[model samples]
Target chain A: MKRTVPLVITFIVGLVLIAAMFIPHWPFTGLDSKFSIFYDVIAVFAFILGGGNLLKVHLSRIQNRRRDWKYSIVTVSGFFLMLGAGLLKIGVPGGWTGDYQADGSLLKYLYDATFQPLQATMFSLLAFFVASASYRAFRAKTKEATILLLAAFVILLRPTPLGYYLTFWLPKPLQFLHIPNLSTWIMSVPNMAGQRAIMIGIALGIVSASLRLILGIERSYLGTEGKD
Target chain B: MAEEEKLTIIERLGAVDRRYVFLLIAIAVIIPLVLHYATSIPTSEIVQSLFDKIESLPGGSRILISFDYGPSTVPENQPMANAVTRHALEKSHRIYLMALWPTGSRQSQQLIDEIIKVEFPDKVYGVDWIHLGYKAGNQGLINTLLSDFKGMYTTDMSGKPIDSFPMMKDIRTLRDFDLIIGLGSGFPGTKEWIQFAGDPGDIPVGGGTTAVMAPLLYPYYPKQMVGFMGGLQGAAEYEYALVKKYPKYAKRSRIASTTMGPQVTAHLVIVAFIILGNITYLLERRRKRKYR
Candidate 1:
């Protein structure tokens, strides 16, 4: 009964949403918008559940003294710090009438001074890792590897002065062979074609997978379908 | 001499600690950046198309600028957002800013603070621009906003009702906007904008995206998307175009140009390492063949 009830709900909702897209008459005219609002409202509420789970998991870890429990303390402390800052409107100028994210708020300070830099620094670490990984990957071991190596070499130089400086003197008629021009072509043509194929494949996969879910053939999302 | 008694350059290259590579990259990137090095970028056709579109837009035309990225991609997306916003402001277009990602709203606010308020202090808030903050439905938000903007955004970023903003008076749906500039990085980003809002509303869309995600978006350009800026290189090209035409900005802040120094330096370092690795591999292969 538990499984059937959710399955029926899914099928009905999925079919109706699909139908609404095509019909667009009477109640269905603004049905997508209504459903979207419903989703937004639900998501906002779901945050409590999500936050609760997070607290439960982290608190349990700290209580049990799990491996790396010290990190959990930091996590819990940071979460509560930001949450308290935001919820209490602590240090917000002009009292509660103003925006929580407004200037002079502790939340704003934490976000701008701490969160933004941390995120940017985290993302910037990719440069080092990518440089290290690519050095190892771009070796000429096989025919395909040789092609990739050559392509990587050209592309690496393409966006910078090295590519332009190396090939800027090329004849106008042979401009297509220029490193920058070649790089553009490679990205726009072959890369685009490959991307389109992948997108289309992904779309089809989604449709198929969605159908499996709607028909209740793909109940794995409900947790126990795989075992069954 | 026995192979066991001596080490080849290839073996040595292979044995070099990854930290050394990381350090080399750091030096290559940082020194050039600190020195404010730059190589001028010739605007490519794709970027030129975008520049032309913005240039040709009639004054007072509304441009919906969506920042569907987060702080993680700030290195790539921020410069493009700054340049694109500046170009729109220069054209005297009304900017309707919004965000799909949660972090996008914050990024949008940062842009407005950094560029709009500082550079174009004369521009009015409600009339010249309005920030719609962010919506939570991701692609679902786009689907609704395409047909009905008010259905999604009832209030501006500042919590004022949408009707209160003079600039938002005429905008009823995403279709009302003359163009969409989706500055994004990953899923629920440029791709989602193109699929949901741009395609459905037939709005001309251009994107500023991270380098890694750029190639995936190319297939949509010229047809669905007008043009796109990918990574620091794309941002640099747009900045060059902007300054070349409006030389006043030439003396102004140069985010992408300053960063391009490190970008170019890092690329060279990586390429040199790649070449050395290849040379070592080939030499070792030859040795193994000769032994066999």
Candidate 2:
């Protein structure tokens, strides 16, 4: 009964939503929006579950003195500090009714001082890694690799002034050979074609998957080991 | 040590430690930034189309700009958001701000405080512009918005009822907006808007995205999307276009254009490394054949 009930529910909801897409009537017209709101409300509760799970796992790791457990201290402390600062409205200008992230609030300060800078620092580190990786990976071993290498050079230089200066001496008739022009052609033609093809395939996959789920054939998502 | 000494220069170059490469890149990026170096970046047609759309819009044309990015992408996405907002306001467009990601709400507030309130002091809140804040649903939020805006957003970010705002009076659904600009770095962003709202409602969508995610969006341009700014480069191009059109903004701090100097230097450094690596590879290959 437990398994059947969920399967029956999924089938009904899925079919109803699908019907709602085309019907556009009283019952079906706004059904999607209603379901969306329900999903969002449920998601809020799910966030609480997620937060509890995060604390449980991290606290257990610290308590058990697991490997590299010190990192858990940072994680747990950051979580609690931000939570307390926000919920308690610490240092808020308008007091209890004040915006949690209003100026002069502890939450806003934490976000600006610690959160923003840390996020920027982490993202900026990608440049160094990209530099190192390109040197080692961008090799011209085969004909395709050589073609790829040339394309990479053109794209890498396209946004810079050097891309303009490099082909400046070329005749007016051959201006299409310019790095910027060539880069645009490459992206618009071959790159876009490939992307479109992949998107079509993905759409097809989504349709098939939806059918499976709607028909209750996709029971693996129910954590039933995909069994009947 | 003795065996290492016997290796040729090409072999040594090929095997150079990655740490040295990282140091060179850092030096390349820092030199331009510290020197306040600047340059002219030619605006591309894709970026120009977005600028033109805003330019061509009549005064009080409702434009919905969604901030779907977060703090990590502030450097890339923020400039695009700021530039688009400034352009929209300059044309007297009624702006509606919302967010898909949770952090996006803060990002929107930052834009409002730093750019809107500071620069366009005459622009009234809840009339000229309003922030609907971030909603929990991803694509589902968009799906709902396609049919109803008030269904998802009952109040503005500050808790004032959305119906109380003059701008919210005419905005019944996503279709009410003349244009939709989605600034996002990843999923549930520009793509979701295109799929769930723009395409279905036939609304013109345009926005900026990170360079890495730009290619995925090209197929939708000029059709599903009006036009889009790809990345830091796209942002720079848009900034340049803005300066060319409005000379008053020429002296203002154009973050994207200024950052281009460092971007150019870093790209050159990467290009140089590629050349060096390839040259060493060819030399080593020739030597191997000769010895064989």
Candidate 3:
């Protein structure tokens, strides 16, 4: 009964939503959106579950004196600090009625001082890593590698002023040889063709997988396998 | 004999320390940034289509802009948001702001502070523009809004009922908007908007995204999407178009174009390193053949 009941519910709901897409009338017209709202309401509760789970795991680590438990202290403390600031609307004007992210609020200050800069710093590291990796990996050792390398040269250089100067000497007749023009053609044609084919393939895969789930053949999501 | 002694200069360069490459890249970025170097930006057809769509719209046409990215993408996405917001307001279009990510609310607030509040102080809130704020549920949220926009969002970002906002009177669902632009970094972003809101509602969808995500969006151009801006370069091109149409903006600080000098310099440095690496590879192969 445990698995059967849930599967039955899923089949009913899935079929209704699928029918909603095609029917678009009366009770079935907005059923998908109604279901979406139900999902959102449930998701809001799931956030509470997720937050509690995070605290539990980290607190357990600290209690057990586990490896790198010290880092958990930072996570746990930061989480609480943000939660308190946001919930209480600390430093926000008009007390509890004010916006949580009002200019003078503690949550606003923390986001600006800690969150924003930390996020930017993490993303900025990608530039250095990309440079180091490209230097080491962009060698033309094979025909495929050479083709990739040449394409990379054009795309990478296309946006730069140096690329413009490099091919500016070409006559108007051969202007298609210009780096920017050539890169655009590559992106709009070859790259787009590849992307479209991949997207179509993914769409078909999703349709099949969704159908399987709707038909009760895909039970892995229910945390059981094989016979279940 | 020392093993290093037998290697040619080119071979040695192929084996050059990555630290040097990092240092050179750092210098390349820092120097241009310090100098405030600027360059002429060329607009692409894809980016121009978005700009044109916004420009062609009549006054009071509602344009919804969703901030579907977080702080990490501020450098790439922020300028796109600002440029579009500025352009839309300049044309007297009504603006509707919303977010898919939690951090997006803060990002939108930044745009409000930096662009709308400061530049277009005469633009009245609730009448000219409104922020619906961040909501959870990702693509599900979009789907919910498609059928019942008001059902999903009862209040503005500041907690006032959206019904009180004059600008929102005509905006019953996704189809009401003249345009929808998603400034996003990843999933539940531009792609989700294209699928759930744009295609289903038959609304024009466009966006700006990080460079790494740009390739994925190209296939949608001129069809599923009106057009889009990709990365910092894309933002710079849009900014150039903005300035070209309205010369008054030329005097203001353009973030993307200013940042391009460093970005371009770094690209050149990486290109030089790649060339050096390839030269070293070819040289080593020749040496091996000669020894054989």
Docking class of 2: medium
State residue B156's C-alpha deviation in candidate 1, in Å: 1.3
* Model 3 DockQ class: medium
lDDT of 2 at B21: 96
- For each candidate, the alpha-carbon lDDT, in order, equals 0.85, 0.88, 0.90
Best by DockQ: 3
Ranking by DockQ: 3, 2, 1
lDDT string for model 2 (B32-124, tens) is: 999999776778888899999999999999999999988999889999998898889988999999998988999999999899999999999
TM-score, one value per model: 0.96, 0.96, 0.96
- By DockQ, the better pick of 2 and 3 is 3
Error of 1 at A7 (Å): 1.8
Q: Which digits, one per residue and each the tens of the lDDT, describe model 3 over residues A53-118?
A: 999999999999999999999999999998999898999998988898999999999999999899
TM-score quality measure for candidate 3: 0.96
lDDT of 3: 0.90
> Candidate 1 lDDT, tens digit per residue, B30-118?
89977889766778888888988999999988888998988889878999989999999999999988988878988889988999999
**C-alpha displacement of B50 in model 3, angstroms?**
0.5
* Candidate 2 backbone collisions, by pair: none
Indicate the worst ten consecutive residues by lDDT in candidate 3 chain B. Answer: B1-10
